[model samples]
Target chain A: MLVHHLYSGGKDSSLAAWILTRLGYEVKLVTVSFGLLDNWRFARETAERLGFEHQVLYLPREVLEKAAEIAIEDGRPNNAIQFIHEKALEALASLPEVGRVSDGTRRDDRVPLLDLSKARSLEDRFGVAYIRPLLGLGYKTIRELTERLFIVEIRESEELEKADYEVELRHIMREKGLDPLEIFPKRHYQSRVLGWREKGI
Target chain B: MLVHHLYSGGKDSSLAAWILTRLGYEVKLVTVSFGLLDNWRFARETAERLGFEHQVLYLPREVLEKAAEIAIEDGRPNNAIQFIHEKALEALASLPEVGRVSDGTRRDDRVPLLDLSKARSLEDRFGVAYIRPLLGLGYKTIRELTERLFIVEIRESEELEKADYEVELRHIMREKGLDPLEIFPKRHYQSRVLGWREKGI
Candidate 1:
């Protein structure tokens, strides 16, 4: 089956893509750009190295802003991220070639989580299957698998300059002369994927 | 330090003992018996195989009955199991050589858990440090480590013929002509460690 995987070039996403490839699925790596300071350069590099068809979907600034506004109003990033993720899935589902959508959402992930209600709605509305390959696996399992399968470089999310919804939301807050810290608290132990070496068996 | 580890001859306890040994601690394995139909044969066998000093402490039947009564009263096994666990810790703390007591409690374990208040009281009153080596590690991590470190035999709790508080509680219900099934529901995946082969590095 043709599976459009939401790739962020992170360890979890990379591992999920690797699993799909191993499972004999025709996987297409899709990374969404929210018009942040960073781009999908590393994601493209990862896709090339892993040898999968890659695509970059640019999300409009207004959509991202609307999600950010909701997040700010709710005083939590989780709601905002989930909103953005649903929108991204909707965009992917609109494509005729994409019969299924998948992401790297693991058992431990709280944000960007497709709740059961939302998942059911998407499947019923678009007649598309939503799959999360790593949903059963926890954080430690994912990290261990990533270490064994690929030579990965781990860095702080900020240092990696990876394009994500949070970066754009922070930028919007800054542009409006509002304290980003008030809207979004600093997260600890947020590791971002910089690059990878040889794919270990 | 001489640490008395509560050994059940199960995967979690065995893994906990393995981790403690790796950490260079003088470990003593203790298996508590509540005088059920099942015996401590496998626990003794595991201790012999692992080359640790093994001690089997007999828990009074009345104590187990009291805990079981409480569980029946509350209609929950968690509180009852926790009570039994605390009593076991108390018994271990009374030992002259045992400066600290440890257990196989992992991050995923809900029943038989030492809550913060109980843990604090144990430490303050008895001056015994309670250590749970596998407390930070989840089921996936523990299972992965068990697979890598030792050759394990997995089976249901009933099939193992191992003496545990649960068995004794059920026995008490059976003696009173009460349906044990009503009190303790059948658990699907209860793996007991029959034995291990060569210990991996």
Candidate 2:
């Protein structure tokens, strides 16, 4: 009955957690932290505002180290971020108490997308249900739903600095003497959940 | 916002309607019928048990007639059913009061599946959000969720006689002097939601 949502402190994952709760699943928001930055704490704050239990899942630096290598070699962040997303999902699915693991990857998502075969492989191997509440939805529809159900703050992805693989991946890239902005795209807007709309939409 | 869910009186659509309601959408369960049979009335009873507003959206017989031609010509029901599913979604999206249209199409569904391009096209042309709540979930996961949430009756597709495109498609096939059993897979099982589990899972 309990589902662990891969929380990024952003509107998408926050909305996913809310949806699970509404579907009668006890949702625990978990942020995977590689210890590159303190962004997970920001996710914790957002989770608190949403009134859900939040926890930080710490992975060894090596998991992200490999992803960084991929990013540097490929001269792009998409594949590296995707690798991290899979690792995060695998880690969540491996938890003893986690029967269902979810994320906010939508239909339009590219960098951190999990394909169906990979998702099914995780489920079959780990004996956990991989639930993606936003997978059926597109970018515009997600924006509409979030606008209806949440009070969100939108800013440039770098300025927002929410808890996600990109934050830590960018840090690793910078540590390796590569400018993240050059490697990753600019003008990317990230949304962080402020709280629910006081008066229902 | 109000969402018109294409209801089949089956567990998938029923669960989709429940999910939409939980996500704070005013859900109207609509059964798209070609009037080949009275199966839509059966869906109405199930919708009543679930306490949602139910309506029957009647399509012109010619639509199913086209689909029937495809099925009989192809010697299979998959493409034919898929054709009907698209038409049903389009009809729901075109309704004056409907700003959001959804279906019970899941990740593993084959016959009635709508690809992302088609879904987006519907959204663009109809000015409605094409929402598929179960799109991220596979058949096994759906079975688990339904077990937790509703009391479902499982039987052969022919015996169940649900208000889905398949039911009407089969009727048309029989009327055209083709045996549906020879066309559709014989071992296929259909589930109908009787009511919610009293004590919960």
Off by over 4 Å in 1: A1-201, B36-38, B156-160
lDDT of 2 by residue, A131-193 (tens): 889988767668877888888887766643678788788888788888887877776776778
Instruction: List fnat, each candidate.
Output: 0.00, 0.64
Q: Summarize candidate 1's per-residue lDDT along A24-106 as a digit string, tens digits.
A: 45799999877675567767877777777889888788878898688779877778888888899888877888777888876
Among all candidates shown, the one with the greatest DockQ? 2
Clashing pairs in 2: none
Q: What is the lDDT of residue B20 in candidate 2?
A: 81
Residue A167, model 1: lDDT of 72
B45-66: candidate 2 lDDT, tens digit per residue: 9988888889999998999999
Give the 10-residue window scoring lowest on summed lDDT in candidate 2 chain A. Answer: A192-201
Candidate 2 lDDT at A102 equals 91
